[model samples]
Target: MKIRKNTLLIMMILLTVTFMFANTKNVSAKVTFNKTSKSITKGKNYTIKISGVKSKNIKKVKLKYNKKIIKVKKLRKNKYRITGKKKGKTTLKATVKYLLFDYTPAVKTIKCKINVKNKAAKKKKTNNKKNNDSEENIKPEIDWGENNIDKLIAQIEQSKTYKGTLYKLNDYTVFNKGEDGGEDQYGLITSPFYSTIDWYSKKDYDKIMNEVKRIVKESKITDDMIDEEKAYRIGRYMVKHIDYDYSVYGQRIYETLFDKKTVCAGYSVTYALICRYIGIDCDFVHTSGFYIDGQNMNHAWNYIKLGDYYYVVDLTDAYCGQKYDITGPFFRESGYVDSKQMSYIDEKYKTSDYTKDHKVDNISHYMRCKKNGDMSQTLTDSELYNLPE
Candidate 1:
């Protein structure tokens, strides 16, 4: 009886150990980059494969390269693959969570070094050699029409202006007074624009412009598209790429082009510049509005001429509530303004006169104007008169 009892106890211990091992081994997975032994060139694409154990019911297999999520693909029941573009020392890790148990988690990690060599870098080096060899065979041609005219205009505009003083204007004061001094008014100044243009040489500017042109051309984007869908798309794109920095009160269109940092004015000016570059008639309009938090302030936005009517767009306003507090001065309070209230301004002044003072209560008044078949009465003469001088 004692022997039988001891035997039973040993069997129970063995079973417990086996169960623990099974959970630890089978519940976890691993992935490794094959070329982990050496540094690879930058910009070279490489694949890392994950293997060992069943990943059939895995919830997520996140492959991170220097903390950035690389593209992960499932190969089979227990295999996965990851592709990465950046070249540097990257640590790859695999995380698998069992779907059946929400709390149960498994993780396996491996460190790998990737040195990606850019093919374009090598090609550029070779091209420079070839250009040197054929130096006498090529003649430099000056593009006086477009290049010179643009440079001269930029120089003149930049030379004549200063980084105009920016003062925070009270919404109520501007709303009732009909005009804030131009110096204190919110607008993109010529100096900053010129400075931005000068910051990028003709070559660099051409490259950026060409990049935009390529995107437009390759996508087969047209003027009609710009007038309709493209404008909004550009707005969204700018908002996504450019971030608002409250530290910098304002940014010029050129700065936004090069530095890619901007505030509301930057978004509107950049939009207008790109539109004009693409032969679309667009204009910058100044408006004052408090963002959702109700801190009434001066602001700027844009108007895009599409067909016979002008469409109002405030990229800043559209991006206000996202990723940041809309109540902050950097993000104006105007995003809450409804479309009906927006329609109160005359089409010409929609971009400029739509101020923060016009609350939701004004919607009915604007709607009445639209219903009366009198576009003239849409905006009060006083509203237009109060716009920035």
Candidate 2:
């Protein structure tokens, strides 16, 4: 088993060359951190992501950071989660490996600078601003048609298209005597808010719709939000800012937007407008009468189509001018519909809901997910968006 010194030296040289070649094979890819620096409160986590490569494209990742200042966890091959252990700064360094364009294994280094803030300091500033906002929003001075709200609405409406006939002057059963001297029914459609129809439209048919949509389009809607999130956020915003004033244009959404005040009808129509703009399937829900607090009165709300079923949402009842509690939104308020009773079909105004007094009046053009019991449960994002094709 003895080998010559010259032979051993030659084998050593070959091994050294092979090691150098292997080290030289891997090249750096042009990778950069998604955000060079991110700021969050203490004990909060920030996403560690890199640009120019997706999580799926990554093959492997190795992270190095100070454990005393932060804790890093790998969410995916390329994506990592960094939690701030203390209120300070930490540099999270990652060596990511991915397949290059030619399918060669490439490595790149990226760093994310994390700055964590003290929760106490953050909460102080938030509270100060909130107190000031409460004072201003408590009695907001809104123009109750100073510059002509209808005109402003008409401008926006002129550029938009609508579904169904935008008819005006909704008339109900008004018995008129015919030439035969008998009573003749002349009213067209029986609606949930036939009594409040006078208060519904602002002026004419088109202009009335103009104000409702104008506010929604002009409101603060972001692209990153899902349909459910958008709907709930907008509804919550109105509840927080809008004052309930039934004095002028209370039923129309114009007053809700401009005057910063409106009734139940305004809330419904405004939300419906929001849903329409966001590409969410929504309905004009009306309730002839539903018993509430020992009174049987009419109400108006919306029924939006999410996934396979439509859920009733009464935004007015959700908050009632109080703080916005998301648990009472949409499906949470309507309760849950079992599979056996999934008869959302039938052209009923079921979208408006609250139809104990008049069961047949809550007819929606589409199917309505029948609500039973008082279920305080809400649906998750997966259930809302993932629909059966």
Candidate 3:
């Protein structure tokens, strides 16, 4: 009896130790900066990269530092370029809010100390910030072959299969076209002819473009129709023909054309394509962080510029109507518009109501293509298309 009691006490001690070890979980995550300290000449740029966070997981990245010591800008998800502005010392505090386990959002911050030296401040310092923004110096790692913003926007505008791909894509750095010509990490280009699916997708691309024109003709969209009427008709026609298929390549235009189904990206790409054939001013605006049906994710939508203000035309959100019943920000109305009454992109965004807003940091996108999303909604002229004031 004495021996058994001693053995039992030992076993209990060992079990308690094991449980304590198991409880040591990394809740905040291990955030690290490449350089803990650095010294650089004024006007020279120093790169500081953060580790322990993936690009997709990053919700929002912010830098806290004195602007007088350096001018910093985000080079990518994990990197920052800091140019010394004057002879001084400052610390770069980078805070990153990222999703944990791809579900829960968490934040962590790391700091880097820096010392700047040189007579760089001798030049007129009053307009340095403006000058830095206005000037474009091509760098090797993230090169935009074209430096002029206006010219680049014009060039891309002319290249879309339709006008709103611009709105759907909206300056997501991939559109910035670094030296590799807009290739993303997934080895895919924004266009079928660009890369990834290049040669094999040509026929598919041709098929979709031809189909877009045919669909417009079938809709009886006359040249005399106002832009709003034409857009409403074409948008409804797109929703009627295509069902929502949440899958890989759902963001690509050709995929939606061939499959007759796609996620929000596919809708944006197709809508942009159709608008191109019909002659309309449109583009795509995307957010890395968004919410749909109670889940946080990324989303894309169509935007149109009408005079002084920008209007939205999210056909994807319209999937909420009498057809696709996904129960997202998409209302029963023909398309997405906020209370501001511009147009419906995502009514949940830019609204005064925080009750439904799921904005976590800056992360806005879908975690997965909703596999079971259904669609039967169509514009059918029953919905109203309110043009921008």
Candidate 4:
């Protein structure tokens, strides 16, 4: 009986030792992040794969960056694939929780150094050359007719007579109120006119010409600086000073310029006029199917052609007020408007290549092509023939 008892005690001790050893083995699972070269371009997509993990009871594997979840994908038993977009350094890790033992946890992690290349770095150089070539190639299409200042002034005055008449939608009448009951009125009231005139009156034209020359001489503004940066700066400045008031519905140019009050349309038109007066090539763009908080509406904005590319400038968005709950000014407030937030003037704007985060809906215009051959109302052959030769 004594020997049997001793044998039983020895068996129990061996079993306990074997169990402890098994518990310390950790299931022999390993994890690795493939493609750790750590170099990628900004605004591009990339993928990473995690392999070498061996565990049947593993639940989930999470890949994180700076403690933020980057991606999580399951592949059968112990494999995973993670994909991420954006540029920045990120932390990577994998965790496996056993199903049977609630307390058993398996964790492994590594530090990944990621480098983001600039998206525009290569395109910018090529774009610069293309811009210079296009600028040189562009020539004025309209004939000024013998530099006849008197004739120009007379024509401008005649056009001005139709000002203040509401613009009718769908018709390009320069003076009379537009069709659709002037609902499409875009410009503000100025002296005798409600709509924008391509040519100014004698007095205003002379003053504007003098101011242009003065500005050129003083170097306050230059043709070279009339690019995206200049437009952005002007947009920011205008939005800062102008107060958005929806009550001034269908208000003409005079009200915005003198009263410093206007809506998105007024703000855009006013800015475009100012830019034109300063010798910048700009135009008003009409976008269809616009929405404020998801309600569909028609909207207008400005598109400025700088060099070769046309950039969109929406003054309303540039100067939009902060959310009521948020306090203080936006950090990094320079021309850093998020393109995704804008509703473009054109509906069929190029969007496939861009990521969802960079996408903006309801685009009314692209500056490069606004009122160009494709979108603008052109004088038909018959209409041109009707004009007196």
Candidate 5:
């Protein structure tokens, strides 16, 4: 009986030692993050994988982020994946639990740092601040091209597709080799073809020229008017007379003059046409502007040369459905009557690509075609013939 008791004590000691060793070795797993840190752009995705989870009895692996729970997807035998969901600095822990032989569970955790960058968001914020500052700090200038005057005159002369004015001024005509002889034709010598005339029928073309003549005659605009005065008078007349048309569609010039209902295009084109007829240098300036719908659409306006400097003339905004003495001292206070015309326009059209109205001391920037944008949005047959219903 004594021997048996000694043997029993030895067996109990050995069993206890074995149990402790087994407990210490309960499903040991090595966890490592595929990446310690990662950067991702906003609205983009980044994934991290954890490997070396050697425990076969692993019940599950979990990843927590942004106050949300994520069940790690098993990539293979002992690998897991965690996808990031938010921007900024983030820390995540891979928690793994597994059952031991005795059915008891053990937990192991490993941590990793992740940084996500939202460059797009940051850029937008910076751009807004810069745009506000640019209005005053930046000066606006137009390239006007290598042959600005000749190009402008040619555009105007070629615009007479229906043939009211064979020549607005003698300078508008260039010698071209015709079947008869080298005849003086409209447009530049380099580009003599009437490329924009296909859209107008004889009647429509006649109406366009006749309307231009009518505006000149009615406004009493003559060669006696200086360029600066002519530009201002035209702006004032269009704003006071032309009603802002929100619904009028199709022919812009016709609707502007005949119906007295037109949008920016009508206002701008009418201004350009009148300017060209009266010998004031002007052109249509097109730009991409945010509309009431919060979308960027192609918008139209005008730029005119006044003395040695150029100015932006936005008639659509100037009218404001009221008449004011454009020549009064009140109008002359800011060197531009537009400050009295509409304040909203003063803000909306202040982009560096548009105008530099805040710094009225400097000449305004021309809303010229930047890169891929078209330099001209003339109501040519190529652009206007196919209406978008």
Candidate 6:
């Protein structure tokens, strides 16, 4: 009986130990990048590694980067070499996928900031004392936070060297009213218009603005209209009024507001300004997409925020009836979503959601059947504007 009791006690102890062992969690391998951040010369190769990961345990290591801008090469086991071909800041991510051994598959990731500097440009900057002296007088450029956009627009309009491009406005006080410390690209001035003409003078600027206001007044756009309603009316107005042609003053503010014959730049700029006039936060989106002839070209458009979602307005494409049927910013083909225009949604404006639910069916057929189609259905006050019922 004593022997039986001893055996039973030993069995109970063994069972308790087995239960605890079965419930124990698997230990994870500590993975870390060799360096948290790095700055390297452009066109030079640099080594990056995941220190704590075992080569045998790793199924494979993958490096994610902008292939167009940066290049990566895998060297020995658990090591990678990265080279930035362009002068900019890009994030390098190394994902170490582990091989499951008596446990669920676990993965580890390490990220390192890679800043590629142009060595020659830096040296030139150091040598240029005149530029440094003048920079103190020059105000800094900003990405956002200027409350008076109308005043900024007026200032840009009045500049004799406006250069149709937003480049000059990047440094002006009214435009860059705030500080930006995010990335180099966060400092660039962006606009939907592509013309490179000068702003002319205050007389021309006032005339153009007065004409714009007259059109808005004629269209009867008021504060009572929601953002979507305002945008729809403005887009429709541009399509009806503006012709796809060049003017003597060029395809820009003067041509768009006065002559009524302008290209994508004029159409997009007019739409953006009209929306802004009616208290809608709208901006220009520069994109590259297929033109009417199936040829890829740089296009200009506008993006507006309605309710909580953001949608794109390609007035040029819509006016030509090329992209009038697509639901959002993408074209639908064979039940799949395809990007029609590559907009500035990457780390610049944070408009990535421009591609979500952006598909509509029978685009080519619809456009072929109905040239210069009426897109009143697509830009309805209820559907596009999200009016409160």
Candidate 5 backbone collisions, by pair = none
TM-score, every prediction:
0.33, 0.37, 0.35, 0.31, 0.36, 0.38
Across residues 85-157, which tens digit of lDDT does each residue of candidate 6 receive?
8888888887777754444466767788888887555233243435644322443332332223343443443
Candidate 6 accuracy as TM-score: 0.38
Residue 352 shift from truth in candidate 5, angstroms: 15
Scored by CA lDDT, what does every candidate get?
Answer: 0.44, 0.52, 0.53, 0.44, 0.49, 0.53
After superposition, candidate 4 runs with Cα above 4 Å error: 1-226, 288-296, 321-389
lDDT of 1 by residue, 197-238 (tens): 222333554455554554344433333222443454455556
Q: Across residues 336-362, which tens digit of lDDT does each residue of candidate 5 receive? A: 434323333323345674344223324
| Clash counts for all predictions | 15, 12, 30, 24, 0, 0
- Tell how far residue 375 is off in model 5, in angstroms: 33
Candidate 3 has an lDDT of 0.53
Residue 256 lDDT (model 1): 70
Residue-level lDDT tens digits of model 3 in 1-389: 99999999999999987765443236354667878899888766776778765556778888899998889876457667778898899998988887765366677788899999994343542624333431122111322232222234333422222222221122221222223354322112332222122122323434654566577767656443445556666776777788876655556766777778888878876676566445565554455445568775666766543322234557776774547432233212213334323333344344555213222211111111122231112122222232111
Off by over 4 Å in 3: 1-201, 247-249, 289-296, 324-389
CA lDDT, candidate 3, residue 51: 72
Query: TM-score: which is higher, 5 or 6?
Result: 6
Better of 2 and 3 by lDDT: 3
**Candidate 6 regions off by >4 Å?**
1-200, 246-249, 288-296, 322-340, 343-389
Model 2 Cα displacement at 104 (Å)? 31
